[model samples]
Target chain A: MPLQNIKVIAFDADDTLWVNETFFRKAEEDFCALLEGYMPKEEANKLLFDMEIGNLPLYGYGIKPFTLSLIEAAIVVSKGTMPIELVQKLIDIGKKMLEAPVELIDGIEITLKELSKKYRLVMATKGDLLDQERKLIKSGLEKYFHHIEIVSDKTEKHYKKLVKHLDIQENEFLMVGNSLKSDILPVLNIGAHAFHIPFHTTWAHEMIYEEINHPNFKSFTKASDLLQIL
Target chain B: MPLQNIKVIAFDADDTLWVNETFFRKAEEDFCALLEGYMPKEEANKLLFDMEIGNLPLYGYGIKPFTLSLIEAAIVVSKGTMPIELVQKLIDIGKKMLEAPVELIDGIEITLKELSKKYRLVMATKGDLLDQERKLIKSGLEKYFHHIEIVSDKTEKHYKKLVKHLDIQENEFLMVGNSLKSDILPVLNIGAHAFHIPFHTTWAHEMIYEEINHPNFKSFTKASDLLQIL
Candidate 1:
């Protein structure tokens, strides 16, 4: 309830302060059009999602595998009807995803500007080399983080690694984000505090359990709405 | 262009037929507030991003790990200030995502109904088990799809698997939807016809390359606006 003894605060990227997944969705419709007559619209999406799920272990989080996956899907769907020129364009579409600009959520800048005054912020996320860095730079929020880790996994080991690298005790750190899995759970497991914030577009992969009875778990309903509370 | 030899049509899920990402976004803002005095807002987001990136491998796609990621970020940001009472509520958000009824995109059902008359329809998407199924069932789109496959990856192997399973050829299929990686590129890669219909709320991973110069690769700028082309 009362803000007391707060030391280091961690934030989640993607859907937290800015919009991320929604942009990826824009490409989905474009992708579906690539295979109109061969398979059903939903079948094609299933195929791509399967590739993403399959490649997650090998590729982690990035656009390259997704591109390759699309390429692979195109090949399967082509089945002899797709033209070379058209296939080339489809491949290009996959590559273009790498360069998408970051768009922050509304009211985010003002809320962050206000919250920055009271907390020592850090960015803890999982993504590829260029994608995450590009987002940070594009979002104009990179300067705020004292530490940035683009990890392949977010297991307990990962959290412990960050704690060790930052030299911040669990008790002295707090986590925040739209994801309970990466944003809240591990940090809480380590005896740190956590805040759960539900987002609108909960990705199928990023969604996780919420915390209610932990020694240090909290939640809010809005961005700037919480500024006065803090 | 004129419809030629088009028979069965496939649709990609996520952004093609409905709006999905808006939910997670609203949740993230709530997650960020737990880090009042510990960290700045930007720092908190970066940390949350780190955590999400970490969870990509472990959870892959679904609401489970995503929710967990948020909870973890909350803990890390709190640094001990996040009250435990909010933890359960945070986890509940994940369940809420599943429980939330499917809200179709503007004119999705109408478009699908119209398109079904001229082509065979089915759904092809890659996502978490319960999440996609729940969405499909609640959206009432399940009846339209003659074949539905919720696979782990969308690769050549999987497409071929679907093709063999569904007894369809690439030339006889057309994939439509809002994802480039899942719907466009992969279907194109397989020598099949593909369509690119762009959606506004695409996911980051699903967005891919775009090409306006393909023979078999067709696209519609708007979802329900497809009728205008004919």
Candidate 2:
């Protein structure tokens, strides 16, 4: 069946807009290389991941300046293998992370420009507040969106707030992104239609979530290809 | 300050008890190299991430024999440049990913050994059922807990079902992992105390969810360090 009633189409900003994971992934590799003298990559990453996960409650998601976490993780993993250079290396990675310009996803602008005409296109992404806004504004894609929802979480509260903020009906909305946990599944749970467009190299964290067994949820292989359903 | 009423502790398997992201991340690096011959690393990754984000509704986590996705992506990124050797290279990377072993986090065995003395200790992880179960069983760490809850997702319904399967109380359960999106956040929502042990180089697909902002949710840098709280 055609997915109609999707009056509000929300897009995830990170991988959906540009690239998010690989940049961080590259920085992490560099971080590990710098720490190779003190600890093996596997040991060092385990420690780093432990610290990052533990600190999520305090730092939230994208608001987290991961450089600090990277430094702290180095110290923890070093276990007194103490080194000053590693901390500096993490700082360098952070600079690279922020200074990196946004790279638009293939066919994203073309699809958005086209979809905006037929639907009330809104950007519903979850990430650090300023960074996401910066990306949207810098890409010049911000103006086309009727509403922009940048949230740390995409729980029911996050979705409900977006619905209210945008004055949208849950049934008339569609959320798209790579994350089943954050995008399709949750949106489907709330009586909204979600068109999942998964990315490659699915994060282990995002990998844990399962597909929704529902009538409303749908999926596509590419952003431009989503036009048929839209 | 003490974690109370906790009888059973469940751990997310993939990167929780063991190291998996590193291999995946490494595989991604190799995959990108293979694709770069046809498309820029940036463009190749953007397309891969985009395609991955699209598959969540269809695949739903556990690094599904993702060779199909990788092959499909390479051809798309090639835009007619895909050569047989490159396809073979991509297959080789996919094979490496499939063969990557689950290396446990340092000190996990020691810590879990201690925790198992006081708690029921279930491995509440999700993945390819056989793969997840195999990783656990082969690790020789499978005998530590009384329960093993392996499934595709861990929503309220999933958690509730697992709890029923294990016959545990709401206040007595704890979920631990590197992703707040999966391991920490959902458990907290369902009236349980979750331990967020963040991992650097977490999977990109993992939803970077917001905090519960509730009192019962919790986190720690080291599993051994959890002793201080208890």
| Predicted structure with the largest TM-score when compared to the true one | 2
lDDT of 2 by residue, B1-230 (tens): 43667878888877778888787777677778876667788788778877766644444454433543565566677764554455445545654554566688877887788887888788876554435655776677877976456544677766776666556777778888878877776777788778877666787678575645667766677666766665
| Tens-digit lDDT track of model 2 for A29-146 | 7778887887898887777777777755434455233654675676666664544444445555765675678888777898899899988888876565445656787888987787
Model 1 bad stretches (over 4 Å): A1-3, A79-81, A209-213, B1-230
iRMS per model in Å: 21.7, 19.7
lDDT (Cα, tens digit) per residue for candidate 1, span A160-218: 76666556676777777777777778777887777766677775677655436776877
Model 1 docking category? incorrect
Q: lDDT scores for all predictions? A: 0.66, 0.69
What does chain B score (TM) in every candidate?
Answer: 0.84, 0.91
Q: Point to the candidate with the largest lDDT.
A: 2
